[model samples]
Target: MSRTRRTLIWGALAIVAVVPIAAAAYSPFLAWRSPVYIVAGFAGIIGMVLLLVQPLLAGGYLPGLSAYHSHYIHRWVGAALVTAIIGHVAGLWVTSPPDMVDALLFVSPTPFSAWGVIAMWALFAAAFLALLRRRLHLRFRTWRLGHTTLTSVTVLGSVVHAMLIEGTMENMTKTALCVLVLSASIKTLADLRVWVIRTRRFD
Candidate 1:
């Protein structure tokens, strides 16, 4: 399929997967689980997976794409993932006022609440550091190290939060998603190590 077609297909699938959970007033399965929370959870999980897949997809895990095209696609995909994450968070807040307040205050009394808060903060830190990387006039190595550290913490915290939550994702799906998150994280670390080694060797 063409790149545009592929993008549309994936984008539509994402919407379809998320719409049911988002549109409902309450969860179909769990009476206590709100639709907004379920949708947000789905969005976050899908966003995480897409983020993991972006590099491979852009790098021609299938064939027939130029490097420029791949890079362009990667940029668009990254933006979409960020949009999805924002939607997830916003929907959750709109649906659950009490939970949102507790989560924001870091006093939810839920195992995942603290982790989610940490992840949210780490995300902001990473974004801010990226934006100011050049303005801060830090050395390339130092900036890179800080960026990677913050990103790792964010992903780790998010995974922990997702695992601790027992609402939308249940049993096998939850376990599989957790494993996918962990695997993606480990793969990213390995890729970074390879890049560092190659850079040092060239230097």
Candidate 2:
């Protein structure tokens, strides 16, 4: 097969694998609970997976792709991730009013709530900074430093939140998903560090 055809095939296969897992995680309806929550939880899981892939795609780790293609995919996937997280939070708010208040106050009875909140804020900050990166006259080095710091916090908080939550991601499948997400995040961070070091040495 041609390289482009092979890439498309693999990407399709990945999407296929992801769909059923998402469906299973977020069933259409639960006997005693609202479907919105389920949908949001599943969206959250999918968002994390997309976030994991964004760095890889942007780094051209995906087979038969150019850097520009990777960059485009990364940007769109990031937007999707943000949308999914918003849906997840909104659903949780609708389903559990008191819990939402506690989460906002960072005093939720659930250990994971605080982490989730923190991650949300970090994500916001990172997004905002990305938008302002050029306007802020940020040196590439400084911008990278700040971005890495915030991204690390976001990933850590997200992992903690996922692990502590007993809702959608409660079993071995979720556990594996979490590990994959963490590994991906770690790999990206390591790569970034290496890049920075090499650039500094060359300069």
Candidate 3:
């Protein structure tokens, strides 16, 4: 990890993480869409990008940040992730009440709706449990199990949800982002080795 190499790696990651959202911003779909819908769509795109960062931060794979700072940023990133999701859903609800209702009720005819709803709930659940883990007196193993399980559900559902839709985002960039996100998440989870973990307080 020489300084130059680390800089290159971080720069590449930044480009990859930012490209899809950048491409989406120029989408012709915006011309026909309401302003609220456009913002909602970008919120979803930003949320997907944050998913790529979350695991990289958790696993300390990014350059320049030590464990403590990385974990500290991870917490705030998680909060931003939640806010992005809320904005996405809230804007969508405002743009189309019936569609939002159908999606929320899990009875939407569109397949992606169900996946997005499931992922949204799983994400909220993971955040909620993390926030209350201390209050709940959860053991390390218990917390790890619940967190990872919810994470897998969230990743799986979100990738499927994003992939199933043909929206403002350019398809190739979206696919690349999705693949990176899934790969990063799977690698980080495998590295955790939760069953053998030592209950260290790195977080």
Tell me, by TM-score, which candidate is best. 3
Badly placed stretches (over 4 Å) of model 3 are none
Per-residue CA lDDT of candidate 2, range 72-132, in tens?
7776776777788888898888888898999989887788889999988887787777768
Clashes of each: 0, 0, 0
Alpha-carbon deviation at 12 in model 3, angstroms:
1.0
lDDT of 3 by residue, 1-203 (tens): 89999999899998997889889999988999999999999999999999999999989999899989999999899999999999999999999999999999989999999999999999999999888988999987888789888978988999999999988999999999999999999899889776665657744
Tens-place lDDT per residue, model 1, 1-203, is 78888787567546544443343324345566666766787777666565455545433442456656765675576567667777778888888878978988988989798898787777668667766777998766776678667767777887788778766555455555556556666665666562352333100
Using all chains and alpha carbons, the TM-scores for the candidates as numbered come to 0.68, 0.83, 0.97
Q: To one decimal, what is the Cα RMSD in angstroms of model 3 from the true structure?
A: 1.0
The alpha-carbon deviation from the true structure for residue 56 of candidate 2, after best TM-score superposition, in angstroms, is: 1.1
lDDT of 1 at 190: 67
lDDT of each: 0.65, 0.73, 0.92
Which structure among the candidates has the greatest lDDT? 3
Q: TM-score ranking from best to worst?
A: 3, 2, 1
Q: How far out, in Å, is residue 26 in model 2?
A: 7.2
Cα RMSD for candidate 1?
Answer: 5.7
Candidate 1 wrongly placed segments (more than 4 Å): 1-27, 30-38, 54-75, 194-203
